[model samples]
Target chain A: MSAAGAGPGSREGHREPRRAVDGALRADTADTADTADTADTADNPGLAARVTTRRGGFTLDVAVEVAHGEVVAVLGPNGSGKSTLLGTLAGLFDPESATVTLADRVLTDTDAGITVPVHRRRVGLLSQQALLFPHLTAHENVAFGPRCAGQGRRAAGAVADRWLAEMGVAELADRRPSELSGGQAQRVAIARALAVEPDLLLLDEPFAALDVDAAPAVRAVLRRVVRDSVVGGQTVLLVTHDVLDAVVLADRLVVLADGEVVEQGPTAEVLARPRSGFAARIAGLDLVTGTACAGGLHTLDGTLVSGAASEPLDHGDPAVAVFAPRSVAVHRERPAGSPRNVVPVRLAAMEPQGEVVRLRAGASGRGPAWGEGLAADVTPAAVAELGVEPGDELWFAVKATEVAVHPSGR
Target chain B: MTRAAPSSPRTRSSRTGSTGHTLPWPVWVPAVVGFGLIAVPVAGLVLRADWPNFLTLITSDAALDALRLSLQTGLTSTALCLLFGTPLALVLARSDLPGLPVWRSIVLLPLVLPPVVGGLTLLFLLGRTGPVGQLLDAWFGVTVPFSTVAVVIAQTFVAMPFLVVSLEGALRTAGDRYEAVAATLGASPMTALRRVTIPVVLPGLVSGAVLAFARALGEFGATVAFAGSLQGTTRTLPLLIYLDSQDDLDSAVALSLLLVVVAVVVIVATRTRDASGVR
Candidate 1:
């Protein structure tokens, strides 16, 4: 029942905070700087939390910090504890041992036995579904938080109207939840969450239930509100599956995998030079982990991947070579004259990616050691001409200049 | 095999209806017969009523007093059921308390227990020589047996299970998704219950109360056993009807029709509210 034993396996794979590449933002350095700068000051940085909780068979052990008026997007695949992290922060779910400090307020400190109840936490949450109160009109739904906070009826209605207008749903104020469309309902939900002026906002995939046409508009509204609404300097923790949301709305990106933080940095920097396999996959780049060699890296499977060094590395230091799928050329035979890196692979699957067919290739032969291979984006005409099917022995060639070698934290 | 032409919209519609029909033809015969089994008795009750003297028969002082007492006790019992049974239903449906199925079964015992047994159960606890009755008699010299309060207590004993079962089903179906949302919006537990939980299940509450009222109005065996049929004091409409039926058949039938009409009105009112789909 102790916190140390809560997640025995988490610490074993917990690597030291990965060093950022050249021209990249390092979270560790920034955290230290913020700490040093705010040591004696009364100014509080928004939210700093260390959460360790286990639900069912899954264990989530993570530490996260967000500055005031900052939006940190948590990106992860399903079952990666993204929602659990938000729940822990919002006080909807209890954590075994957690220190969640928001806006200089000790919301949760299990050591101190000061776990604030959800209603008193002042952490507004906008879940995937709108989840508006069915019996209330849009205006009343928005007014709910204010009323709960003991506002007068007239004052609450005024606040509701203001928020409704802010979310562009003022005209739908009197309409009940059932009368509003999906987009309108979501807009009302956003207004309801913001009406509280919470110290921290927890958004769990708010745009996920929205249609493509609605998603962009909602995302834009969220971007505007999260950035422009600095009245309370609200710190927002947004959990999302879409990379575009991170790109558009977030100031930083925290990538989670298997209930642990894999990588985190400034959004653009992490997307550009992702260290974890999960981040690389979401960024649509192929990452090959290996040992630093003369030019690039020697993969575990003995494939010498040559690429330009994006970060400094010592001899035999652990490193990774990253390349885009479009940089790879598929050949029937090993016919790479210019490209230095060539590997013999077996076609695993072919998926159409808009204008091109993404041919996924893995290690050839019946070896149990199927190295995470490369994805090659070839034109459909080229695929038809090559007549390639799954299990076909193919040669994947990548130009050395296309790949970027960097020192990996692992 | 000969085939009919796929001709008119009318024929096509009929065939489509046949295609959609999942049950066999024989099922309809038994279903209709089952419907008649319930409907025919009510038809007979209407047909057997002495219409010419209906006003005179139902306007007697005993009849009026019984009717008034039935309404008063039924309403009070229904209110009591709502006040007590709502929290019980909420606990049974929402709380994570262990051994809840046992508690739920115990609460629903009145539904399955015969009315006479239920009356005896209440009597043993509250009768003059019983423990609670003895305490009351010793402390306040207040006798509860064979009183109007006894009638209400017996009615609530047998009728509250309906309210509990109905409201519990509604609470379970409505779920806590809205309640969770309300909590996130800064609503405390009480506020969420008053605003979100109660409002969401208002229709169910109304229907459950109506059902409890109807059952209380029709209570006879429990009332007769626990609170003897004293015309103006302990006797309700059903007890009066039972008493009058022994000798005055005409008044008994008229009272019976009045009870039926009241039950129908209660049921119809609830139906109209449900049909309106008012939150």
Candidate 2:
């Protein structure tokens, strides 16, 4: 509903964007400065947008403000309306209600009865398939945008060459799209989207079709090209199902489920403490499902798991109680506590991960969660100190507030 | 369990007629007879042609007039098919306009109609005394039937379905994905249509036009009945051939051979280009 903290989360814990890729280009501060010298980014400062669209029975209501040069990755499951959001912004569909503006230009404001046509919207969209015009060469494919913007063939061809060079696919320019490898075609498609100097960019699962070997190369290109230092940080909305795409390239993360923004924050923040099931699964956390009762959650079979709400839910409404595995504290005995949420469980498995051991526990020594249930990330030191191993009985305890309850993502 | 020898080129050659029998005698018997039924009539025409006098027969004044008329009318009809029939096919492929199937069937009617039947329908619709034709006669004082224009109209009526059907299939195969992508790249609808949609379906359009041209060239009953058979005006090659059949049987056979050659050439040329498909 509002735009707050729209800039990307701090770029930390990421692979160096400037790792010597192909031994030719390095995405470093100098590269950014060099790009700033060549391109005029000040003319297109990123703008905030509020998008609301309803298709058939599905309605997606989301507001996102992409800071100048920030990449916002919209992470969601299939049929969760990620593509719908991008399509609405790109002027493919006139939303039921939306007010989308990039910089001073009003692309779509349904209330004002002003909806720019797609070609005039200045929002370049790339989908999972590169969809290169088969009849066009890679050079001509990249030139298409500039050509459509009224550049002559020679000038547009020059622009295409420049972009192809920047993307490290210049040598393949003359080859038709059918002659291009999947990765090469995707790179050209990306270059084509940027050639027109659009104010906003929308990528719909851009890497989903690429093999694992080709994805990282394109990801590197996005990191180097889409950053504020290089391309003047035009606002980009990347719709992806892969967490790695969010972690590597996105500054902010907006997790959608069933056409609603279930959780959103800095890429690291939401990932650190996912509040929804889809988010939690992608973030690698344990999420317990239940219905909200007077005091806490009532599991499917009426087992009570007490937890505080990150956002309040009406009693009897569906809810999912979620917490990071690291949040659970495993104990050897039933620890005495004052109204703390605690459960007796059998330690199903213990696997060492870095400095910590991943512990899988069930509801109790006898229950459906007997073999695999709650997961807790404890230090390898703790595993040694507590002498915990597979099939060991233990008690798991957590502060009710640490486990966040929210409306079900379904 | 007993097993037959593994299939190799050597073994397959032995199994087939090239070496010995592979299929049963009954299968080849009916199939070859069926093939000969079509082959014999075509062979008869080819064999009956007076090769030495073929050029002289075709170059005769009446034959030349008819040949010229056929070419002119065929070209005009094909042009009309491209101009109007392509848009019709686009509408059929892309739109949900009411009565769509009815319109499609109407376009398809001439394809299945007996040439004489098509000619009769056109004669009724455009005859000087008919309802619509009467209005045109009153307003412009232009009669439609039994004229050069009428010949083209008759040819187009029979040929247009070929063009529209081919184009609709092409448009459907090309789909809207490329056009949608083009729009996102800042292409206006018209630009996308011209630059993306048209080029993508060009092969289909070409084949359709070629087929229409061939159909128009061969049109006889419709052109003769609706447009009349007048030398240098409405009479076309097919009409000339039919009229010649009553007396000059040798010339008619030669002309028939030429028509068969032209049709085969047209089909082969277009099909080969499609098989090669734009690389």
- Top candidate, metric TM-score: 1
Q: What is the DockQ of each candidate?
A: 0.22, 0.26
Strongest candidate by DockQ: 2
Model 2 stretches with alpha carbons more than 4 Å out: A1-47, A285-410, B1-40, B272-279
| Colliding pairs, model 2 | A69-A233
lDDT for position A299 in model 2: 75
lDDT of 2 at A260: 73
lDDT by residue (tens digit), candidate 1, B109-176: 99999998888877888899999999999999999889999999999999999999999988888788
Model 2 chain B weakest lDDT span, ten residues long: B1-10
Per-residue lDDT over B1-279 for candidate 2, one digit per residue giving the tens place of the 0 to 100 score: 011111112333354457543798789889999999999999988788898998998778987787778878899999999999999999999887999999999889998889999998888888998888898899999999999999999999999999999999988877787888898889999999988888778888988899899989999889888999888988888988999999999889887887787788877887777646554
lDDT score of residue B123 within candidate 1: 84
TM-score of chain B of 1: 0.90
Clashing pairs in 1: none
- Chain B TM-score, structure 2: 0.84
Docking class of 2: acceptable
Instruction: Give me the runs in candidate 1 sitting further than 4 Å from their true place.
Output: A1-42, A229-233, A285-376, A379-410, B1-30, B277-279
